[model samples]
Target chain A: MPGEHSSKQYDTDLETIRSKVLAMGGLVENQFQDAISCFRTGNVAQAEQVIKADENVNNLEVSLDDACSHLIVKRQPAANDLRTVMATIKVITDLERIGDESTKIARAAKSITERGVTTINHYETIRVMSISASNMLHDALDAFARLDGKQAIRLIAQDELVDHEFRSIMRTLITFMMEDPRTISGALDTLWVAKAIERIGDHAKNIAEYVIYIVEGKDIRHTDYAASQLEDRTTN
Target chain B: MPGEHSSKQYDTDLETIRSKVLAMGGLVENQFQDAISCFRTGNVAQAEQVIKADENVNNLEVSLDDACSHLIVKRQPAANDLRTVMATIKVITDLERIGDESTKIARAAKSITERGVTTINHYETIRVMSISASNMLHDALDAFARLDGKQAIRLIAQDELVDHEFRSIMRTLITFMMEDPRTISGALDTLWVAKAIERIGDHAKNIAEYVIYIVEGKDIRHTDYAASQLEDRTTN
Candidate 1:
C-alpha cells in the first residue's frame, strides 16, 4: 500500500500547487471584471487587453497541472491528500474555462462597441449579472483557499440569482430585438455577453462543489437543488 | 522505485476502466442523436427521454472516477499507464458534460415544440450540424478505443467544419428572427440547440486531444488551429 510522504517537501509542493491555483483564480477574476468594464464603457481597448491577458491564465493552468502531476508521482499521497490534488486539477480546468469565457465576453464587447450601438436599458441587467458572477468567483476562490465548505455552500445558492438575472436580461434583449430589427445584431452580441457571464457563474458553482467535495468527502454534484439546500442548512 | 505491475489483474483493471469510458461515450452519443431527432420530429416526449437519460451518464462518470482512483491507489501506474488513466478521468468529464449539453438541447427542443413552431427551412441546417457533431463524437470514441493518435489528430480538424456549420446556422437563424419578430422565441431556442451542438463538437475535440496526449505523451491542447493541422499532417 502507498503511504503519504512524511517529508516537508511534499507539503510544500502541495501548498505551491494550491497557491498557483489561487493566483490563477485571481487573474481570471480580474479578466472577468475587465471584460465587464469593457462592456459598460464600450472600451474596445480594454476588451483587447482582457483578451490578450488570457495567455497568462492558460500558461498558469499548464504549470499548475504539471505541478500537480509531479507531486502525485513523487509523493504518492493517499486519501485526503490525493483528493486535494485531484480537486486542484479539476478546479484549474474550471478556472481556465472561466478565463476563456471572460475572453468571449471581451470579444463580444469589442464587437458591440465597434458596431457603435448603445445598450441603453439592458446595460443595467448585464451589469448586475456580471457583478454577481464576479463576486461568486471571488468568493469561491476564497472558499477554496480556506477549505471552507460552508462558504462554498453559500456560494452555490448565488448561482440561482445569476441565472435568473441572465434569463431576465435575455427576455429584455429579445423584446428589444423584436421591437426594432435594427438592434438584432447588437442585441445578439449582448445576449452572448450575458451567456458568457452566466457560464462563469456555472464554473464558480463547479468550484464551490469541488470545495465541498474536498472538505467533506461528499459528492454533491447533480443533486437536486432542494436536497442540496437541505444539506447546506444541515451542514452549516 | 515503482516498477510497472506485470500482473494480469492490472491489465484487466485498465481494460475495465476503458470499457466504462467507452460505454459512457456511447450513451452520450445516443443522447445527442436523440435530442436531434426530437428536434426534427418535434417530439416533446422524446426530448424528455433524453433529459431523463442524463442521470445514467452522471452515474457512469462517478463510477468511472471512483474506479480510476482505486486503480491509481492499487496499481500506482506510472508513465504512459498513468497518462492513460489521467486522460480517462478527463475524458469522462467531457463525456458527462456532452450528455448535459444534449439535455440542454432536448430541453430547448421541448420548449420550441410546445410553442408549436415547425423548424421549416432551418431544420436542415440544424440536422446537418447535429450529424456532424455526432459523427465527431463517434470518431473520437473510436480513436480513444484504438489509441489512434493519427485518427484523433484528423478528428481535431473536423471540429473546424462543425464550427463553420454552427456559424452558418446562427446567421440563418438571426436572419429568420430579424425577418419575423414572431420567430424570435423559437429562433432563440433553435440558436441554443445549435450552440449546444457546437459545444458537443468541442467536447469531442477535447476527447480526441486527450487521446493524442495519451498516445504521444505530448500536450497539444490550447495550441493554434494551424499548428494542430500541421501536426495532423506530419503525424499521420
Candidate 2:
C-alpha cells in the first residue's frame, strides 16, 4: 500500500470499478432478502426501509456509469479491457433493475399486509419462487465476478425452473381465488409479489447472458427460454 | 446520396445510427400492433408472425451495440458525441425489450384464442391502453430524434395514464373472474396480455427518461413515476 507506482493506477481504477459492481450486487441482494422478509411477516416498516434504500442502489448505478465513461475516455482501452468495462457497465444496469424489482416486491408486501395475510399453504409456492430467484441472482453476480461462462449457463437453465414455478404458482392461485371469491383481493397481491420474483429471475438470467458474452464473446439472448422449458418437459 | 464529402462522414455515421434507432422502433411498434390485432381477432397466424419477427429486433441490437463499441474505440469521441452514443446504446435495449413484450402478448393472444375469446365489452380497456402505450413509444422516439426534453416529460406523464388503465383492467378482470368461474382461464389470458401492454408503457417511459438525460445532461431515472401518479389523484 505504501509504494505503489503511479503507472499501475489504471489497474487500480479497473479493480475499483469491479469491486463497486460487486458492492452494488450485494446491496440489491440484501434489498431483495429484506423485501421477502417483509412479505413473509407483513412488516410494513421494513418494506418502507427497502423502498427508501433503493435510492442508494440508483445512485451507485449513476456513479458507476460515469466512472466507466471516464475510464473509456481516458484510457481508450484495448479490445479485451474494453470488453471488461462494457460488461461492468451492463452488469450494473441489471443489478439496478434487480433493485427496482425488490422495491416493487416491497410495495407488494405492503399492499398484501394491508389486505391481510392468507394461510401459509396458499403462499408456500411464493417462498419457493423467492428462493429460486434469489439464488439465481447471487449465482449470476458470482459468475460475473469470476467470468465463468459455464456456471452462467447453469444459472440460465435455473431460470427455466423459476418459470415453471411461476406457472405453477399462477395455476394454484387461480384455483385459490376461484374456490373463494373473498380471497380474490389477497390472492391478487400475492400474484403481484410472485410476478416480481419471476422478473427478478429474468434480470438474473440477463446478467448471466452478459457473463457468457464477456467470457466467450457469444450473444445467447433472445433464445426463447420458454421454448427450452417446453422441450425440457417433453424429453424428460 | 453519392456526392457527400468524406469530412462530413462522422455526421453521417451518427445519422445512420439515429435512423437505425428509429427503424428498430418502427419494427417494434409494428410487432406490438400486430400482436394486439391477433389478440383482438383471435388471429393465431398473425401472432406467430409477431413471435418470429422478434429475431430481427434481436439481431439489430447486437449489430448496433458493436457499431457503438467500434465508434467509441476508433473515434474516442469527446463528451457530447459520447453522450449520443451512450444514449443510443441504452435506447436500443429498451426497444428490444418492447419487442419482447410484444412477443409475450402474441403468445398470450395464441393462448387466448385456444381458450376461446369473450365478447368485446370486456376488452375495450385494452384497446385504450394499447393506444396510450403506443403513442408514448412513438413520441419517445420522436423526442430522441428532436432532442426534445419537454415532450419527453409529457410522455412521462402519459405513462401514468397507461398505468391507471392497467390497474382498472386488472380490477375488471378480477370481477369478471369472480362473476363466473368458467371465465377464469380466458380472464387470466386477458390479464397477461394487459400486463404486457402495461410493461410496453414502462419501456416507452424508460426511453423517455433517456431522452431527458441526453437533452438535459441530467439523470432523471428512478424518480417514482407511480408516486407522482398518486399525487395527481388527490390534488386534482
Best by DockQ: 1
Residue-wise C-alpha lDDT for candidate 2, range A22-93, written one tens digit per residue:
999999999999999988888899999999999999999999988988887777766656666777788888
Tens digits of per-residue lDDT for model 1, B1-236 = 12444556778899999998998998999999899888778889999999999999998988888888888777766654777788888999999999999999889878877877774535676888888989899999999999988788888988999999988988998888889888888888888889999999999999999998888877777886435566766899
Q: After superposition, how far is residue A32 of candidate 2 from its true place, in Å?
A: 0.9
Question: Cα RMSD to native, each candidate?
Answer: 2.9, 5.1
Q: How many residue pairs clash in each candidate?
A: 0, 0
Docking class of 2: medium
Candidate 2 regions with alpha-carbon error over 4 angstroms: A1-8, A117-121, A223-236, B1-8, B117-121, B224-236
**TM-score values for chain B across all models:** 0.92, 0.88
lDDT assessment of candidate 2: 0.83
Q: Which stretches of candidate 1 lie over 4 Å from their true place?
A: A1-7, A119-122, A225-236, B1-8, B119-121, B225-236
lDDT of 1 by residue, A16-108 (tens): 889889999999999999998888888989999999999999888777877787787778777657777888888999999999999998998
